[model samples]
Every structure is written in C-alpha cells, then in structure tokens.
Target: MNHNLMDSTINEAQCLMQALQSAGFAAYLVGGAVRDLLLGRVPKDFDIATAALPDQVIAVCRSRGWSIIDKLGKNFGVTAVIVKGVTLEVATFRRECYGEDAHRPEQVWYGTSLKEDLARRDFTINAMALSLQGDIIDPFGGQQDLARQLIRTVGNPKERFQEDALRMFRACRFAAQLGFIVDEAALVALSEFHTRVRGLALERVRDEISLTLIADQPDVGLGILVHAGLILEECRIKVQGVYHPVPLLSELGDLVDVPQNPAYHVHDVWRHTLAAVQAVPPKLVLRWAALLHDVAKGRQGVRGQNQAGQPTDHGHDRQGAVLAEKMLKRLDLPARFRTRVVWLVLNHMRFHMNFNSVLDGQGLTSLKHWVREEARSGLFRTAEEMHEAFDQLAVLCAADAKATGRQFGHEHEREKFLLILADILQSMPVHSRELRLVVDDIFQEETERRLIGPCLKGLLLRVQDGMLSNERQELTVAARKWLKKHKQL
Candidate 1:
C-alpha cells in the first residue's frame, strides 16, 4: 500500500496520535479517513484505531487535559474527543463474530494488530489504515481496489454480508457517493445474498437509501440495486408500478436534464423516482421524499379512455402518498419528516394539474381558486414552508413528466408553469425583515395601529378563510361595531 498522506489531514491525525503516544498507547489513523486522504478528498471525520482499549483511550485523553466523551454501546466501540470544536473518534482495534445474522460477535476480541482489525472490516477500500508514522497497512489490497474505483468486500463477501446485512446497502451507497463501481464478484454476491439485508435495522437501511438518493449519480446506484434484485429484498417493500410501459426521457444522459413529457411515462415509478431524487439538492428528508413520491403510480395508473383513449394516472398522487407514508414508517423516519414527505407526495400532482388546466387563459380563475383554498386550509400558508414544498414538488413533477417521453402541445404552457413557480419563490417575504419591525412604535402610529395585539393576529390567521367562505364582509362590519362599543375611536 502507498503511504503518502495529505499534509493537512496528516497534521490533524498526528496531533491526536502524539497525544495518545505521549501517554504510552499505540494509535494510528484508520478507516475511511485513511482511504479519503489517499484519494485526495477531505475526510468528513478522522478516526484513530488504538491498541489500547476504550478505557485506556479515556485515560490517555484525561492525562492530556482533553475531555473524552464515551459514546460506545453494546456491539460498537467508540470514544470521542473534542479539540477546538473538531471531534475525533478513537476506537480500539477489535474483531467481531456474527451471532444470528443480526449483530456481530456477540463477543468482541480486542486485537493489538492493525491487520486483524483491517481484516474484519466490511469493504476493501475501507479496510486500509494509515499510521501516525505515515505507514500504510493494506493486508487486504484495499489500495488496489481504491485505484480501480471498486467496492469489494474485505474478505469473503458472503461471510461479511452475513455478519451484517447493512454492508450490502452500504456498498451500493459508496459506489453511488464516490462514483465507483461495485466489483463484479461483489455484485454477484449481492444478488445471491440480498435477502440478508432483511436482518438489518430499519433506520440503518433508511440512512443508506437516503445517502444513495443524494449521490451525484443516484440512478447508477439505484440501477445496480434494481439489477441485482436487491431493492425488494433489502427494502422489504414492493414497487407498485415496476412493470408499466412508460415513455423514456430523451435526454436521460444529460446532467440535470428535465425533459417535458405528456404521454405515458416509460420509466416505472421507481426509475422516475430515482431521477427525481437526483434532481433535488442533497437534503436528507427532501431527497428521501423525492425518491418515494410516485411509488404508487404504477399500481394506480389505469388504462382508461381519456377523450382520446389515452391512459391516465388520475389519483396516483393520493395513492402514492399512502405508499410513501408506509415506506417511511417502516424505516422509522422522524414523524415530522414522514408527514412532510407524505404531504409533498399527495400534492405533487396539484401544480401540474393546474398547469394543464390553465394552459389556456380560461383556467386561471380556477387555478387561483385552488391556490386560495390551499392557503386558507394552511396547506402552504407560511412563505418558507410553501417555497420548500413547491421546490421539491416541481422537481418531482418535472422528472415524472420527462420520464414519459411526450411533449406538451403548447410550449408556452410549460414556460408559464416555470414562471409561476419563480413568482411564488420570489413572493415570499424574508423572515428576518419581518422580525425587524418595532411593534411598540408601530402600535403607537395610526397607520400601523391595526397590526397590534393578539386579536389582530388571530384575525389575520382567519382572514383568508373568511374571505373564501364569503364571511369577510360580515366580519368587517362586526369588527367596526365592536370597536365603536369599546369607544377606542
């Protein structure tokens, strides 16, 4: 293995190593940090593997006047140290064994050899380690795999996967994240051992899938998972519309290309969803929602006769929302994230429907009505919430439409929708500006007096609703009467 460390990372790791060695314990930079440094990527976090046990690491840190945060748990070994706000994870070199396909090594055997530790890792590229003295330890040929841009199991793929099924998904996620390819042998093993993923925890699987969705090339990762037949096996869920004959996006190879399609979508819900997921910013919750938004389109799309005998997915958004909720729940995502995702999926079709209806000037009134109704119902009342929802929804809808391969008859219709979305985004008031108002001074001024007090705030909340319900005029009259009775004027 090559052992030329990036100067900056080496300095960081050496600082920790010196601290440990001064207290008489062996320590070395290890795992992903070493791999990243070799690849010239800034490592997200640095980790040190020490021959000293977890307790010993704490003692070394305490002797150096450093605060140690023991974050270790059963079946996992870790201790964190904070130095100038940067955290470094220090773990003992240990070997693990699988008990019943759920957890590794019902008992752990701490080892003094770095080779032993590297041999027990999940992937070849992740098994390499770097020493404080700048020595590279690659008993597993991890450097070769790194050079090849391949994700290969550390040792026996079957045994490694059986030890922890989550590694299977991690392999795919790393490939996606790093733009690497899964080793052919590893891919073959993934196909045969895909069922092992069922043994992993839901949250673990959710995280890996989320990472894959946010990758620069998410489709590559998803395609590998689908080709290996591991999506259903690992996810423990079935795609609703995997077999549908949908149109394909013409500019599929282009980066961030979102073509407009109006006919039957060629990509199944899963593939279209992967494309949509790729279109959004790499936000965890938003990407997850994007990937799962149209999961029900395949199951709910009917071969019904439109005026022209074309197929339509009339209520797929509502059905897709239900499916998204179920998938999110199974993964134990936070309740708030689950709710927001389901809401986005449920309403994803609304804007597109509005676009189609309002392509002609005749439907603008109906579009406005729908927008007002949504606002009054508090579906998207706050500017921030509305912006976030619309941004994600637009991306999902555009990807869905593009995957269909049909173009809108009127080019201006699609441009109008884009214009509307841009207008919505710009219409949002900055919260900081809103917060800068001097309420006391405003209340004393006649022009701003109407904005004061809880009554006024409460009225504002209900104002739009009242107008939509045709009660605004009545409420205005009642308010004047009440003010006169109080003699405020």
Candidate 2:
C-alpha cells in the first residue's frame, strides 16, 4: 500500500479507529478498499469493520457531526457516513446463519472476532482487511489468493454459497470486474450449488448479471457462468451448446485480445460487438442496442439448407427483437430502455438490406425514400434524432457485416450508401417543423357557414388537385355551397 496516498483520509480513518480503540473496540479498513490498494487500483469507496456495535459507531459519528445513513433496514448491517465530501461505510463484525440456503440469518450475533467475521465473507479476496496504519489482516490466506489473481471462497465454497445464493452471481461479477480466475474448487462448488441460485431474488441476480456484462472482459465471466451451470439455473434459459451468439460488451478502455476467426468472421461476435458499442457515443439506449443487436442469430440459425439451398437466418432481426424484449423484461429493465433495445434489434438488418437491394440496382432514390418515408416516419422526432439512430444503426450493421466475412460483392453499392447516409446526416436539421393551423380561417366563414362539412371532402379534393385556390375566401365559398346542399355542418 502507498503511504503517500494515505493522508488526512488515513488520519480520519485512524481517528475513527482511535476512538474505537479508546472505547476498547477493534477496527480495520475492510473489503474492497483493502483489496484495491493491494492491486494498486484506486478504491471507489472505503469501508470499515469494527468490534464496536452499530450503536457505538453511530455515537462516535454523531460526536464528530458526521452524517450517517443507516442501511440496517435492508439488513446490510452497515451505515454510510460523509466526511469532507468522501463517503465511508462502517459495519460491525458479526456472524450470520441461513436456514434455507437463500436468506440471511434470522438473527445475527454481533461483536464477533475479525477472523470469525472474515470467515463469513463470500470470497477470500474480499475477506482480507487492512489497518489504518497500513497493517494487512489475512485470516484465510486472502493475500495469497490475491497474489495469485484467484477467486476462492473463504471457507467451504458450498457453505458460503448456500448462505446467500446471490453470492454465486457475485463471484462471477467480481472475477469479471477484476479479471481474475475462479479457483478450481470454487468452480466445482458453483457447478454443484448452481440450482440454489434459482432461489435468489430476481433483482439481485439482475444486478450481478449487469455488472458481469459490463466488465472489462465480460466473455470470461459469462464463460465461467455457463461452464458452472449457473446461467441455466439463474436465467432459466437453456442454451443447447457452446455456440451462443449473444456477445457481452467489455468495459471501456480494456484491451482484449480476441482471437480471429477468418473463415466466417473477421472478428468474433464478442470483439465485434465491443468495437461496435465503442464506435457509438455512449448512451444507455445506444449501448443497449449495440449489445443486443444480434441476439436472434443463435435461435434463428439454420444448419443445413433453406428452399434456395443456402444457409440463412431469415427474419432474424424480427425474431431477435422478440427475444431481446423477453430478456430485458426478465431483468426488470425500464420500458424506455426495453423499447429502444427492441427497436434496434428489429431494424439492425435494415441498412444491409437497403444497400444490397436498392443501392446496387439503379440509384440512391429508393434508399432516400427508405430513410425519409419509412425510417424517419415514427422512429425519431427530430432529424438530429434520426441521424443519431442512423449512425448507431450503421455501426451495428457494419460490425454485423464484418462478422459475415464476405466482401459484399459491390464496392460502388457500399460506397454510395455510406456517402448518402453521411450527406443526409450532415445536412439534417436539428428540430422538426411544427404543424401550424390557421384557426380563425377554419372557425369563421367556412366552418360557421357549414362550408367544411362532410360534403366538402370532394371540394377539398378539387383544391388539392389545383382546381381551387387554397385562399380563405375561395375555400369559404366552396365549403358554403357544399354544406348547404348537404344540409349539415
């Protein structure tokens, strides 16, 4: 640990520790902060575990005028305090029991020793702690596991997992986050206790899944989850074999060396998706789209031949959208995000189809119509919104096309489509034109005199055909005669 980084913050932590020591209570910096410092990573948050009771810790914070946010209602046995704009969490060393392998102990025994407390932690890497004065505490050889870049349970893996089934998912999440390998013993335990994860709450499972998906090398985490049989247990979705097509996006700025598969793809789906996601400016909606763009490929894939004797996943985009919706809903995702993801999934293949069909035939007119009439109709409100959608769609499509490993056959066709899309994107206005109505003209002579009644439809048809000028007086006279004859308003 760097002593220079431990300045006033160390003093503050030490002050808290000194107060506890003066009151005859032991305290230490625990969990992620300790782990991160050892790994030379900047800790996002700091935590403390102490022999003092929660009430005593609260009293100490109150004496210092620190604001404490209690999470005891959530059964976390933790409280967060803000000091000099930095939030620190403090928890009491305690023992817990789970009767059914899902919920926490119905009762907790507080004032436990640090070794006993460390034994209760989910993983050895997280079980270690550090003193305010830079002393390391390792009751379970967590330091050894940390040095080995291994994730192992503090005690019996099965027992740790049975205590809280969500810990299984957390194990995967931590491995993904830190780029560590799960120990063989832990992996075997995970395989055996996989079914226990089904007993966990959906929100807990969903949160861990999200974290794993967004990790530095998400595929590693996901591969472990699948190998351990936890995905089927937690997700209730059966994947027949290993060739699943859904790719997890890696975290930003993480260098991943993805193996090239030159026969069918320039890059694997995982790396392609990661690159595609990075190409788009980061937005929740766009990122979700990029991540789920090809979800249907695995399900819709055909091994042998179609009617035309060619391998095909026809209508995969539509099928993928359906699958994406189901997956997102299962995770309890927001409606707005679900809708955007579905939209992207459904239209991911559109650009390819347009480029192949229209751009190669004659000119850019059909492509333009596709954009203006079909794509712009309800997909976006403003032209700028349409451009953003198009740009993200292009990135996803290009990645998908690149994954196909075909040359696309027509260089002019591809160039034209790209150029036209770029031109439209650059010139597109930022806002849509508002619909304006001449209220007075409609309400006065024409409407009042019953000139704009049902019978006026034919007259309006004539006006649209240029037989009558659209001037108020001309419309009023035409509407009056039609309404009088119809005897209706």
Candidate 3:
C-alpha cells in the first residue's frame, strides 16, 4: 500500500492530524478514508481520530480559527470542522457501552488509546488507521483482510454484532459496495443475531437497503442478508419508518427460484431480474424498476404463457406496477417518484411496440397512421411527447433483454429511424392555427378536451408522418373520420 494518500482532498484532514500530533496528542486519519486510500479509491469524506479529548479537540479548532460543526453533542465524541472550505470530521479516541437494545451506545468514555478505539469499530477493513507521517496502524490485520477481499469484525463476530446489531447489515452493505465477502464467522454470528437487526429504525434500515440496492453488486449484499437469515427481518421495518404491518419487499418471497421457460430465459426468475438490474447503469429508478419488472412471474394469480407457448408473464407489466406502487407507497417514497416508477413498470413491455412493429419494414415511413389510430382509439393515453416516452421505454427494454441473455438489437436500423423521425417532426407545424381551425371545425367541446392530451398529440405525430396535411381542409377530414370512428360524435 502506498503510505502517501494520492487524493488532494485528504490535505485538510492531514493538516488537522499534523496539528494534533504537533500539540503532543496522538492523531491519525482513520476509518473509511484509510481503507479507501489503501485500495486506491478516493474517499468522498475525510475523518480524523485523535487521542485529544472532545473539549481539547473543540479548543484546538477554536485556536486554529476553524468552526465546529454544531453545538457538538450531535455526534458524541465526533465533531466536524470547516477549514479553508473543506469539512473535516474529527473524533476523540473513546470507548462506548451499548444498551440492551443495542440501537446506540448508552454511555461513552473518552481518553482511550488508539488501539482500544480501533477495536470498537464495526469491521476489520474500517478499523485500520493512517498516521500523519504515512505510517499504517492496523493491529487487526485489516490490510491482509482487505487484500483477501473479506468483511470481518474487529473481534468475536457475535460480540461485535451484540454491541451494535446494525453491524450485520453494514457487513452485507460493505460486501455489496466493495464486492467483498463476509467471513464465515461473521455470517454465522449474523444468523444467530438476526433478531437484533430488527431493532434498528426502519428509516435507517431502508436507507441502508437503498444504498445496497444502488451498489455495484447488490446481489452480493442481498445474498448475505438471506443466508444470514436477515431477509425476514425486513418485515419488522415499519412502513415509511412508522406504519404497521410493514409493507416490505420481503413480500416478494422465493422469487429467485421461480421457474422460467428455457427458450427465452435460461435462468430462474430471481436470476433474470437481478441480471436485468445489474445490466443497467446503477440508477435507483432503473435498478428498482428492473428488480420489480417481472415480480409477478409464476405467481398463481398472475396471467401466464404467451401465444407462442413460451412461459409468459402475460400481464406482468401492469401486475408489477401494482406491486411496485404498493411497495414504494409502503416505503414512503415521493408521490411523483412512485407514480413515474409505476408508470414505467406499467408500460415497460410495449413502449417499443409501435416502432418495433414497423422496425423490420416501414418504421420510418410516416407517423400519420399511428397518430390517426391514437385519435380514433378511445383509450389513447400518453403524457409528454412520444419521442421522450419512447426513449425511456427503449432503456427499459434494453435492461429486460440483457437479463434474458439476449440483446435489444437491430441497432443501426433503429438509429436511422430516429434520425428520420426527428427530421419529420421538426418540419411539421402540427400545432398551427390552420390545424387548430380544423380541430375546432370537427370535434365537440367535450371531445376537444380529450384531444388536447393524447388525441391531439397523436394527430400531430400523424401530420409529421405526411399522412395528413397541415392544411385546414385536410386536417378537418382526418379529424372527422377519427372522431366518428371512435364514436366521439
């Protein structure tokens, strides 16, 4: 490991450490920063641990013209200092005693040695420290464990977990985020200590789970949670941190082993879903959508099998949307966010249908017929522009295809179609006063309200396709035929 930290952000913390050391108090860069530095990953935050008491630490900050983070009790022995526009967190070397519930430390005592302080941490990898002179302090062999790609506790796994049960989830989170493995002892301890994991605040649990879901390899973390018997603990997570019956994702029980047809999906339902999730760039929305995209597969109530005889999650798109709505609602996500995710889930399957139907043939021909169909179809329902709608759908399809051991292809042709489509739409004045007159002349006031949404936009798309002229007479005839066909008259 290069003792010299490569990142410039560490300089702020280094200055604090040097100041503490010069003042005859033992100080070093500690926790995650040390671990990430040795791994050559630039840490987002820098923290310093020192033998200086919290009062002494506050005094040093005041003497050095740095502002304390707050009134100071918010973080126990930990304090945040802002120096030269960079925030550095400084903590005193301390030992803590946990209450029987193990949610947080009940009492804390300062003036502890660095060795004792390091021993109190959650994981071996994070227990290591780096001094101002570039020396590493890793009495628990964190460096070796890091090289081995392992997640282990500072001492007896059971004892560590007993002190802070959230450590069990943290272990899985670390495994997921860093692509590491939990040590056998830790896993066993987690299994024995599973109940303690439920004592944590549901919001905190949700936040941790959310972080794991967004990690590079969420499956690793989730698999550990399952193996450690911590999966069911999800039910104890109160809805939005305070609702009863805890609407949990754990409700999607045994989805991993759900069977799928070999022809399209060689893997089981769980594997396929996870594969889709992993295929997408780690956006929370995309990953969450991918995870729940096919959740209804193989369930007794859901429609199954397509016309082709392959196992079909026939109405899974809509079914999964319902489930997603329920789960996200229970988790207390933003209303707009939940609506969008459900919308994406509901339309995920056919978003590419219109263009795809014509892909092998006249996809670029004219948008006129499709728009007319939308105007004529009483069920026409789309928000925003068709182009943006298709864009999101295309991304969903790509993720779905990737999960099934396939690719969404015919790429070059699709690119060409989009280029042509863009040009055609740009040239059309579908919203012109001329077109407005045609609409006014054809449809009733009630019917016009509906057209203002999907119907009107649908016609605009058609006009771009050259199927309908931008002229009043041409649009009038098209509008009458559309309204009459759909019984809007």
Q: Pick the candidate with the highest lDDT.
A: 3
A best-first ranking of the candidates according to their lDDT comes to 3, 1, 2
All models: lDDT? 0.66, 0.66, 0.73
lDDT of 3: 0.73
TM-scores, each model vs. reference: 0.78, 0.73, 0.80
- Clashing residue pairs, candidate 1? 97-105, 241-298, 246-265, 246-266, 247-265, 247-266, 261-406, 262-406, 265-404
lDDT by residue (146-217, candidate 2, tens digit) is: 889999998888888888878888888888788899989889888898777655656667678777766665
Q: Residue by residue across 234-349, what tens digits does model 1's lDDT show?
A: 33333484322211111112212222123555554455666666776677766776676655543524223468655455686787787777767666678878887888788877
Q: Per-residue CA lDDT of candidate 3, range 334-353, in tens?
A: 88667666767877765455
- Candidate 3 error regions (>4 Å): 6-9, 71-75, 235-247, 303-310, 352-355, 362-390, 413-489
Pairs with backbone N, CA or C atoms under 3 Å apart (clashes), candidate 2: 451-479
Model 1 regions more than 4 Å off: 1-6, 10-12, 73-77, 234-268, 300-311, 405-489
Tell me the lDDT of model 2 at 320. Answer: 68
Model 1 lDDT on a 0 to 1 scale: 0.66
Question: lDDT at 303 for candidate 1?
Answer: 22
Where's the lowest-lDDT run of ten residues in candidate 1? 246-255
